[model samples]
Target: MASQPEQRSKVARRALLGTALCAGLVATLLTTGPARADHRDDAWTVSAPAAHEPTAHIRLDDTTGTVSLSVTRRGRTVIEPSPVGIVTEQADLSEGLRFLHRKDRLVDERYRAKSGKRLDRRVRMNETRLSFATPTGARLDLVVRASADGVAYRYVLPGGYGAVLGETSAFNLPPDASAWLGAYRVDNEGQFAQYTAATAPTGEYSDQALFETDGGYTLLAESDLTGDYSGARLAHDQGTGTYRIELADDRVQADGPLATPWRAMVTGDLATVTRSTFTDDLAPASKVPDGSWIKPGTVLWTWLAGGREAGQSLAAQKAYVDYAAERNWPYEAVDAGWYFKAGEWDTTDPDWQTNSWMPELVDYARAKGVGIIVWIHQRELDTPEERAQWLPTLERWGVKGVKIDFMDSEAQPMLRWYDAVLAETAAHHLMVDFHGSTLPKGIQRTWPHVMTLEGVAGEEKRTNTAAHLTTLPFTRNVIGSMDFTPGAFQRVGLRPNSDAAEVGLTVAYESGLQMFAGTPESYDRRPLARAYFDQVPAAWDDTRLLTGRPGREAVLARRGGDRWFLGGVYAGAARTAEVPLTVGPGRWLVETVEDGADGLVRNRRVLRGGDTFAVEVVANGGFAGIACRWRPGVTTCHR
Candidate 1:
């Protein structure tokens, strides 16, 4: 997340990645950057469900005060313990801590998502507790929450500890294990790529580092971050042959009643991990009393149709407003040049008058049924007074949201600043899209108004390849909605995707701010496909991963209202695929827009639960469809 002074450079530095923005402390850690205890035993194992046969085990080693983990599906150990260790200023969890008690319980609950891929969210897990006490009188609770899909554990500081020194939860994988390392060292939001477990880089991280073994897969991520705590990244430990998690900085003083973010590792099939709601399940409930004002919809961006030459002009913006109105798109962005060109950094500047025209544009967009969203550099929102002055004006003008960009740092202070902006914006009933941001750790669950983030190598990266498209759905987008700015129907080299892949991408990405990155003319060329694009909503009632292999191929199903949308995309090879229909028990009418021998074609059929339909995708191509309960006018045959 870049500041106002660096907006230009930040935009120019178009590396990919994004998520919700938070603020707390703002300091940088060393570019290069944890303890040892031994916990290796199968005896400490426990299954996800008490009544079922155990497939995986979490072994706690009291012998050396450490831990080890494994999954039977993979045969060998998945985690060899980068030596189960936790470091702090006044105490080392590894040393002088004795097992005090142990307990286990079954948890089954459900919650609704303020805005998410699914409305009916469920949590089914068997929790295990292991209490430890330090000779220094500091106590810690090691809690593990296990579900059929995966497992997550966190350190609960019961008391008697000093500032956090970080933890040493390194992952030791089997020989054949490979991982999708999202190495943070890669300049910006690092892209995820496959590497042999041992060959994967050490001392780097992608916020959600995904490791796949012959057994299935395990997703390692941090969640539910609260006050005075540091975000963590992985650091490779050569001596231990594992990737140790290092909190952002050195041992900073941590207040009591603190629990480290869940050191979560979910093991399951690719689809299970992809569809897991663990991130949102980890966050605190929404603070907004009434979030009905928050919404998800498609937006039109003028930058695509008008470039730098026409982008900032009143006439070009009006054209975008016209386009949005014509397409029934809900919002239009007045990106980067309404207020000082650099945005409302200091209203005292002579250029402040330039923002006077914003009221007029907002009025025009509103008359056309399109809400306006303006852009501002993160620094412009650094102060409450500044936000009070700026956002109120936008809200008064009936603006729906703001694209706050260039929040280029991830320090604690920066994190706090992000929260401040979100809170301030929510109060005014304006939504947000964070650009030049970090990964989402269920902040959308906490702040429903935060629509999306720019933490993935999305269409904006003119340098991205076809492979980038296949990698994002599993890695960066896994945690939550991202501001990928998808919907490009041009050539792969030009940073757009094939028209065949366009519809799939539209349904594939979940964002409150759903906008395309291509020219209006380019999108207009595919009128048939536009039917799905125009009607599809950004948020969903449910999501289903029918079949997929990260970066290889994916068949996804999502529900919105009574309609179910399906999309299938593949990497570099053409292949036949089958998608199990997830519609309710009743027979449903299905409409498909998929690749045909000559060109893309539309087909209709009737299908029901447990039935699989054939879908064919070309190399670097995709297919899309929609299904819903039978209607009289729509063609449907007996199933």
Candidate 2:
């Protein structure tokens, strides 16, 4: 057995030798291959002999330098430097060890510092290594390894500031070779019991990936804390067969944060290989489930003003219902105050339970074809006494869903209380919306009834600006569906106040059940925007990343059947962005973006097979619903 220092020294030499051997092996197998370019202009390219195989080559080029990586079957990649200027430094070897009872091998690795900062240490393993070479010719190497199920990755840089990100065994599972990735944060006191339960069934081979890319950082957990999975956020891609989890926070990080590193057992099954990445504002690409009871594109109403107070007069309540009916919006919500008095100190009156305005409002909304959701504080229902008092009453009201609010952040008891809330809600065949809460783990996958959460600083806060709205999609939204209360008809702020264009942005954003928060009268005033909202579907069958950089600008294209909706948003300043519409080869009837100048503009244009179109858009402003219909013959059209 080699000493740790000896092993560290052998890594670079061994890697080079291994690469030579692999290259030779490949040559022996094939005489003719794809033409290899010795040198070419910079671009990032990935190549794999076949999709089913585990090996691949990745090339990255930037103004600073170029990085080339060769990934092997065992989840290890070798990086080589290109002739570009980027400085790299090395640090002292720091070793960390983790033991996994399932896999017999001891995952051992030494850490290195690249930036002389412990937090920025680069983790590398025997099979997995990261290196950097500055165009100036400086290089740094980071090495890592795994002990059975545990991983030992090291970050190496120039300074003495280096620490190994290691994990100690706290929980165990039976051995299984399935890849599982989750976006989760480590809550010292367990809160995610259900999450733990979900991963436990997969056996001990499950490696939980925790990340803090949304600014606040935490460890990803394999099990639940107390009863709630506090650190986890909602995200689209929870690794396939392997559980993929996401962690989220509302506070924005200056630079994009690192998502929890993916951890999964190596398997031939592509579905079993869990993969994920962290982004400031990235939404999931998957569609919400479909069923008669739970359909996509349904609008939920929330009666935030005390139901009795807001709808005190039947005429007033009926007016709102009439507004919904006229607008074709589907549902209505009876928020918090409806359960008790709006401002009274002694609000909880046991006798006043059924006599509230909720029942009447529910009946009226039902007759108007609008569904009603009730609001309940989680604290009130934390115990058996609370649950006994509230659950039955809510079920009896025949409410569509309950918006649970004011959940405690770190308390284990509160976590457990939330889990019970979901179970109880599901048992009653009711849907749920978590408010004043954190990001979602993968609970929705197991309990598809849970719709959205208000972890974001949505429109409710009158101070929210366009920057906040623009930032949410890339940062907070990356986790999962956020009930951002998108449609705010009121204009509260200054220059970048919420407007029809902003409303259009929200519709373009993803959500399972969207809430249109504002007086229906406000929506009626903006008919064009209203028409666009009418077109916005709650769930999307497919999503494509059109163009734009993170935060600065983003343009997204989504589709439900043959219809395509395109939206673009800019954060700080007004700028022009080129959006590439290249989903498929088909002629599209394009609308000449109506910027509120002329009545809705429409243009008939035909696109040829295998062609790309570039559309120019302005800054701080965006284009939406420039509808595209597949036209087979029509060619050029006047702009």
Candidate 3:
């Protein structure tokens, strides 16, 4: 019942394996088996053993010597033929190459996560590597991986040293595909917008661009971006429906055998795409000696309300600490200008205020069961010498965390600096939150002490639109922890979304260091909203996108311990969202806070799994709630 081509393929595989065994290559046989050489078209196929898993096809053009790739999932095309190669300062590795050999194996790795959407993660996939030699005899390898959720590939240059000019990596989508992407910026603060393949802006775009194609959904993103290469952006070619990888800087260096970051196409349905951990899976394992010290919880910040003055004033910081202690929040962040004047990073300056009351404030907060997070500019502590001098000092003062701000660069040097700083900070048992920084490339996995990063159009800008808020879950926030600094309840100023939606963002946004920016008095005015934030956690054990449409609405359920926190946000028009109760089987007491046409309203009810919980959400409105397993004595749930 086998076709002619299938018979030849079987013979080739058997012959290749027999030869490898005869050659006494037991290590290679166990890990990589043998490379099946196809004389027909010089193309190799790698797919997950499961029928539902994704499949990738790689081809090396004999005539042009260019490598191209295509992918399919569940018998549907996820990516068309797309060119993938890198350009170095020495040779044109993109074309005019000769095939040398190939190797492949299946990788199934499971690791425990300290703080993320999932507590435990498994990276199960089939990996194939194709080696080629350039005209100048430079060796390069194209490693492709196909998993249950997506396809990922990267270029590895052996014995590479010097400058890497650029990359020819691109994603070719269907002509009719639509995309939700954020514009590329150093700080990555642009709002996401929608566009058809042909109408997408030709400018640069940030990571994690979600596309809706005829076959299924595909999320374009990158991972494992280290100091060896520059941070990359997507440059669109509308006519060809292609988005090419463009390096952030021209001076990308490769000091050794260089391995480019994985360019991933996360493919499947919306839920599959949203739940995919392929990005984090591609990153290196945790480097922290012990992640138990890195606690995740709510933080009270003062910069949003009173700016630098409040963060510098001792009394204001103490008051904020008292409020955090009273609310049982874990941390209070005293932002920039804590011990130095604005634009004055040099501690040697005569007016550096060396005798400030930071030690007293830290002691005060520590006694009240609260920790202090101090802010410092990038210039003050960029080098190893500076970090070595300051990290131990902060630890001595009982500082629990540090907020490093104004990085504003993603060049190769800056990327390396991030890694070094995280290592040094971890040595001192202090967590890190990067502000005005580059987008997260799954670095939190490698450094568990990295709590969050400000790489989005967060609440501080005071220009957040409802559409932007709704789009983040499916776009920016999916890659890693995003520091949106949600829960700003101030009524004055040009606030666009509803009060309920603003309150709901504390749950909607995923951040290890979830900062509630509202002042104590402002939170006192809305006790119901404050009470919701009082109990909701910053990190989660499990996450599910109950229902979502980018730039329209996103309803999510995140579980912490036995309690599940639910959040939803809508844009454009008023509508009724049907939130399915899919937590599990059993009776659950659901307490919800939603938009009440006049303001925020709270309601409680008992529901079972597979029930449809209907909500009346107004234009640009949102909702937040809690759900707990019901027992005979369980009468009330946290609101």
Candidate 4:
């Protein structure tokens, strides 16, 4: 029965207790741990239990007070150097720092994720912090926590350090590292391009990029992002195979002390990185205790190829709702132009820009067991004045959420707007899906209702390929939910998919809104396809990327409502692979779908102690999915 203030006080106390624990560990490490004494004379070296992770150590330069990370596997150094920070302060912080104190400890912490495959929400890390200050009074701390599977670190800027111009944190990889940068090309339609550290273009922005080194794989991402800083992009350094932080804005000014976003890396195993909730761990725990209304389910997009008329007219919207309701889909999205006529949205005369059909359409959809979501230009919701009036108005209209698009920037102001909108929408108990925005940096961890984001080269693209499909799991989607706007069974497009491939897209991509980009008429033809989506979930309880080759193949397993839906994509001539799955030991009733050369075919089988299964995909074709359930120990976790 504690108030909010009391809860906050307890959190502060816990943080102090953690700090104390860290200090005690520091002494233990310095005196008794198997640390190289020369590290203090040269660079303070850090490690986590094994040799395969030779390059995963964090190195702190004692003299310069600079921190960088390098990971090695099998004697090969994969990440040579990735600097942690570069703050512009009056006093010298680069060198001549009199070491103040240090902390080292084993950290164990856990919290519940608002919505995700809620497994292993906690992390046990080998933690440490090196506190340093200058005689001129500049003080800072380089704190790092490394686990057997991942590593996260941040720079703590004490309030007295004057103003910070910005950061110079950079990731410098080795030549052999392969990276998948979001939106590598394709005229910004949202698609990822896979490249090597030696080949990725410079000056380009990627939400989060991956480095496949001999040391395993390193998923580099930003976490627990707060403050006035702009979004961080990986600007490639071709010659040195490094990436520097090209912040969206020049500087972030704060009156109080600020801790930069955690520069996190998960390197070791692909599944270890793939299944990580570390980013969510960095964010504060969910605020909503009873989030029953924050529904995560498939929604139909009216603007998917064709629906503008259907989106605007009460009759057409009703038809779409009929389809959605029949399939048990919870919501439908009305994209662009439903609110007001084109070019008249900002008219001082509100009636000129308003649409009269919206109210009736909302009622029609609501009566049919479906909720309505409208799309808005993000710029329209940038201000409190705009949101205060608009949000309440939308709430009154019975809308569930809004898809706000055209962000196109990662500047500090844009970052501020991101939080502001989420806060307002949350207050009104409405959901938000961001588009034309950069990749999500654990924002959903803080605001669960802030569902999916369009930072990847998703299905909305004029064209999408199996290659793009394969690349997503390794790059665009690892940090948080990605709204690819899937389901393109339209039988046309530069990169159209087979019925099976489309099913695979639904399983592969995780979003707050699992939308089938194809129209109802298109899906209706393939009742089997509709049946797959009818039972699939927008979010999952757990996920496993069984086998994949970037731009070549991806096989994945997702659990929903206690059942597992397994899917995969193969862009080449029909070939088969043994897909590994992590299922609890049991007997399972498995229902499968695969490409039947011209279309998709479905069948069922029973599996015992489900581990790995073999399947084939047609050349340039793929397997959509197969539904599986434990016959003995049934668990409807999401129902």
Clashes of each: 29, 60, 0, 13
The deviation in Å at residue 433 for candidate 3 is 0.6
lDDT of 2 by residue, 243-271 (tens): 22222222212121122222221212211
Looking at model 3, the pairs that clash are none
* Sequence-dependent TM-score of model 2: 0.57
TM-score of each: 0.85, 0.57, 0.92, 0.86
What is candidate 4's lDDT per residue for 382-431, written digit by digit as tens? 78888876788888888898888997777667777876887788888888
- What is the lDDT, from 0 to 100, of the residue 587 in candidate 3? 93
RMSD per candidate (Å) reads 9.0, 17.3, 7.9, 9.0
Ten contiguous residues with the weakest lDDT in model 3? 21-30
Query: What lDDT does each candidate get?
Result: 0.68, 0.43, 0.80, 0.68
Candidate 2 — worst ten consecutive residues by lDDT sum? 112-121
lDDT of 1 by residue, 444-479 (tens): 888878888887777666666556676677777777
- How many clashing residue pairs are found in candidate 3? 0
Candidate 3 vs candidate 4: the TM-score winner is 3
Q: Using lDDT as the measure, what is the rank order of every candidate, best first?
A: 3, 4, 1, 2
* Model 1 CA deviation exceeding 4 Å by range: 1-63, 67-82, 103-108, 158-161, 185-188, 237-241, 308-311, 341-355, 490-492, 576-586, 595-600, 606-611, 630-633, 636-639
Top of the candidates by TM-score: 3
